[model samples]
Target: IDMLHWMSRAALEMIGRSGLGYSFDSLDEGGKPHPYSVAIKQYLPTVSEFHFCREYVLPKLRQFLPPRVCRLALDFIPYKKLHKLRDVVDVMHQTSIEIFEAKKKAFEEGDRAVRAQLEEGKDIMSILIKANSEAAEGDRLSDEEVIAQVPFRTFTFAGTDTTSNALSRILLLLSTRPKVQDRLRAEIAEAISTYGEDMTYDELVSLPFLDAVCRETLRLYPPASLSSRVARRDVSVPLSTPIKGIDGRKMDSILVPEGTKVYVSILNANRDSTLWGPDSYEWKPERWLSPPPQVLTDARIPGVYSNLMTFFGGGRACIGFKFSQLEMKVVLSTLISQFRFSLSKEIEWKMTGVATPWVKGSSVPKLPLTVELLEAV
Candidate 1:
């Protein structure tokens, strides 16, 4: 829990400093619970309630209740009950706007001198804001619109938990495999020793074994399980291999009408033996080191990650792929070098169909682990 929380805080701070010239001070000050965090926490439950109404209550109510009746029902609903929801959302939006306004004010008052000094003078947000200001009116995002997206600017949730969970899982697997862990540790040590004080981006990217381990972990247990897409036009997707239909007849293709919802199962595809060979189910980084079989690399399988779709594929693939990889490597290196992690207790991680898997009990649950500090040579 501590590691995950810290990682989350660090990632958010990093994103803020890199993506924007603002620092949330999440890391340096122990991320002391601020209004923003409180607002976020309160807003989520309210939003969940609103969505629940739309998905469950509203739909069922519409079946029998007339629009006028529904309106009357809402009128009777306690204002106090709804006020909590509205207050939180309002605070969140207001805080975002306030922050954006502050940035703009800083820029106009002193040419962003204040922000430049604080952010080391090279934030992506500043660049974007400048570009947006210089661009044609139609092509640029307004200051208000840009500020409105402040809540989404740092990807606070994703930046924090996803990489940490992935690293935790990898460490757990390594704990079980002593030989593999030792080998990897040795590789890391050798690389560091050879490269001198700091590891460069090129050196990190060139670490084939580390890359393979990260890839393998992502393959076996992708943080994200399912991705959704809607068909733009009527299309027929032919199966690479025939499947026996309910009528016991071989079917080659599935007809998808326009506007049809399609879900691509990334987890299942990652483990498909036909695409990944007999040992597809196993967590073996060696497979990544060697060339995948011709069949697996064929165009039939479209995956941005190891021809297995961990990050999805093509134009719709994750824009943050490189950023995510670098973040993971840096965090993994830092943790592994500093400490040795082991499973604290034997517990099964429950799966969810969301972008990332979570434990069964709560929305943001912790993975328990015991750790020991490594001695400096």
Candidate 2:
């Protein structure tokens, strides 16, 4: 919990510093809550209201009304409530505007001296601002549009928790599997020693064992269990091998008609014994060391990962794949180098079917590993 909190705070501070030249100081120096976080927190109530409307109110209303009537009722629901929701959204917009104006004014007032003193002006938001200023009017995002992205403040919350949870799981596994952990530690140590104090992107990307560890873990237990998509047209997805259907007929394809809602079972596909080998259920990174067998490597499989649909594939795949991978590697290396991790208690991880797995009970483990601080050579 502490690690996750710190990571979230750190990611937020880093994103703020790098993206907008603003510092929340949520991690390093213990900075106070910035307007961004404040604005984001304000939207939580509104989101809850939306959830309440969808889950409780709407369903209850539907019990006595026909489907079409329910639809009309929802449409007829007072615009006043929506307008109120818009007002809450406006707070976020206003806050973003304040941040942008402050930044713009700083840049305009020959405040390059201040920027230089900070040594942190080249962040994502700064770059975006620069681009926005330079671009043609039609190409640029309006202040309102830019402000609407205030919810992105929650990215830190989402990214940090998910990634840290994944890292923690990997550490737990490593601690139990001493041999595997030793191999990984040795691989990382060799890389660092070979590269000296400075590890370049190319060097980091080339760490095969580390990469395999991450891939294998994600394959066995993806943070996200399911993903949904709406079909654009009637489509047929071909199967690698025919399966006997209820009619006792060999079925090679499944027909998905237009507008059909599809939920792809990512976890199921990743661990499918048919796609993977006999030891598919096992967590073996070495399996990824060689080219996957012909059956698994078929192009028809939609996996952003190694013949597994952990990150999905094709046009809708995550754009942050490279970024996430780099972050994971960096964090794992740093932590492993600092201390040894071990399991606090014998427990099974509960699947939440969300982006990250949560322990079954409220009493989630704090990764009570014995942190044996490494000695300097």
Please list the C-alpha lDDT of all candidates, in the order they appear: 0.68, 0.66
Name model 1 segments beyond 4 Å from true.
26-95, 115-122, 147-158, 245-249, 352-364
Residues 1-377 of candidate 2: C-alpha lDDT, one tens digit per residue:
33434444554565555445666654544555454454343344345457657656767877888877754554456776665555666665565567777766676575887545334445656665566767898899976565444223433333444555576678778878878877888888888899965688899879898899898988897767787787999999887778999999999999999988799998889988877978989999898798887887664577676677877888877545555677778777776766666655554554433333234354543454555777775
Report the alpha-carbon TM-score of model 2 versus the true structure: 0.75
Which structure among the candidates has the greatest TM-score? 1
**Alpha carbon deviation, residue 109, candidate 2 (Å):** 5.4
Error of 1 at 57 (Å): 7.9
RMSD (Å) per prediction: 4.9, 6.3
Ten-residue segment with the worst summed lDDT in candidate 1? 351-360
